[model samples]
Target: MFEQFTQDARQTVVLAQSAARRLGHHYIGTEHLLLGLLSQPHTLAARLLVVRGLDLAYAETTVLRLLGTPGLDARDADALGTIGIDLSAIKEKVEATFGRGALDRDPAHTRAGRFAGGGHIPFTKRAKKVLELSLREALRLKHKHIADGHLLLGLLREGEGLAAKVLAEAGIDFAQLRADLDRDIPAVPA
Candidate 1:
C-alpha cells in the first residue's frame, strides 16, 4: 500500500507522527494527519485547504484547545461532568498529591513491548482507518497510486474522528470540499 503512495503522500504520513509527538499526544489521530498535510506547502491537499480558508495556525490552535494539555480529553471531561465527577476537582487533588507533571508521561510510553518505547508513537485506530481508506479511495478512483488528496478524501469519509470534529469546528465545508477534491483531481490515465 505504501508503494502506491506519492512522495508527498508518504511525507504526510511521516509528518503526522511528528505532529502528534510535537503536540504531546500519545497517539497519532486523524487530527494529526490534517496537521501533517497542512504543515507541508508542496502538496495538493495543502494548496486546496489553504485556498479554502483552512488556516494552519488556526487549525493548530483549535486542536490544542480541543485536546487540552496531555491526559485529559475535553470530551471525556464533559462526559464525566454528566455524572458530576468534577474532573477539575480531581485534577486539583491529583496535582496536589503527585506534584506537577505527575500524569505528564504519554500513555504510549507505558504500553508493553512494541509500544513501550518513549519515541514510538502509534496511530490510533481511526487514523489507521484513514490510511486504509485512502488506498480504497485511490482504487475506487481507478488510480494505481495514492496521493495526498486521496488521503484527504479518506479523512472526510472517516467522519467520526477528531479530524472531522476539528474541521467542523473550524467551519470547513466538508461536503463542498469533498466534492471539489473528487472533481478537481483526476485519476492517472490508463
Candidate 2:
C-alpha cells in the first residue's frame, strides 16, 4: 500500500514502522504513530502535540509503562503481548479520512522480505485512515505543510481510537485542545 502515498504520507508510514522496531513492538499501534510524529523535529504535528501539553519525556514514560517495559528488554515480549493496540481499526478510520490513495502499492507481486531483520507489520486500517485525514486536513487548511498538530487534530476527530483514549487518560480535553489549536495555529494566508 505504499504506492498510493505521497512522499510525506509515505514518510509518516516509514517513521511509524521505524518506531515500532525501536520499541520492539510486533504490531503497529496508534501510540507508535504518535511517537513517530514526535520523532520528527519542527514538524507541525510535533509542535501541535507539544502545544497540547504532551511532553515528550512523559509520553515516552507512559508508553513504556503501558508496554510493561520500564527499560528496553528482550524478555518484555510476553508483557508486550498482553497489551494489544488495534491497528486495523485505526486503518479503517484512516481510509475513511484519507481514502486509499494515501498508501503505497500492494506488495502481492514483490518478494516478501523481512524488515530491519524483523517481520513486516503494515499500518492498521485505522492508521492509514488517520494519515489520510491528516493529509486532507492539511491541504484543506492550505497550510502546504503537514504538521504534528494536524495529526493530533486528526486523532481527536477519530474520537474512538486508542490515541484519543490515551489523550483522554492524560487529561487532554478534546474540545479545549481543539480551541487551543485554533488559537495557536497560524491562519492560512488568503
Error of 1 at 86 (Å): 20
RMSD, one per candidate, in order: 6.2, 11.9
Task: Write candidate 2's Cα lDDT for 1-190 as tens digits.
Answer: 3443444445666677777665545556677677777676566556666766785566666775565533335445445545773444544576566443112222341234343335677777677677677666666666665555566666777776556666776787788877775565544422
**Candidate 2: regions farther than 4 A off:** 1-11, 67-113, 116-120, 139-145, 182-190
Relative to the true structure, candidate 2 reaches a TM of 0.58
Top of the candidates by TM-score: 1
1-190 in candidate 1: lDDT tens per residue?
Answer: 8888888888898888777665646678999999989988877788888887786787788886776666568798999999999887887787577543335544545454333334668789999999999988888888888889999999999989888887888778999998888886667621
Worst 10 residues of 1 by lDDT: 109-118
Q: Estimate each model's TM-score.
A: 0.75, 0.58
Model 2 gets an lDDT of 0.60
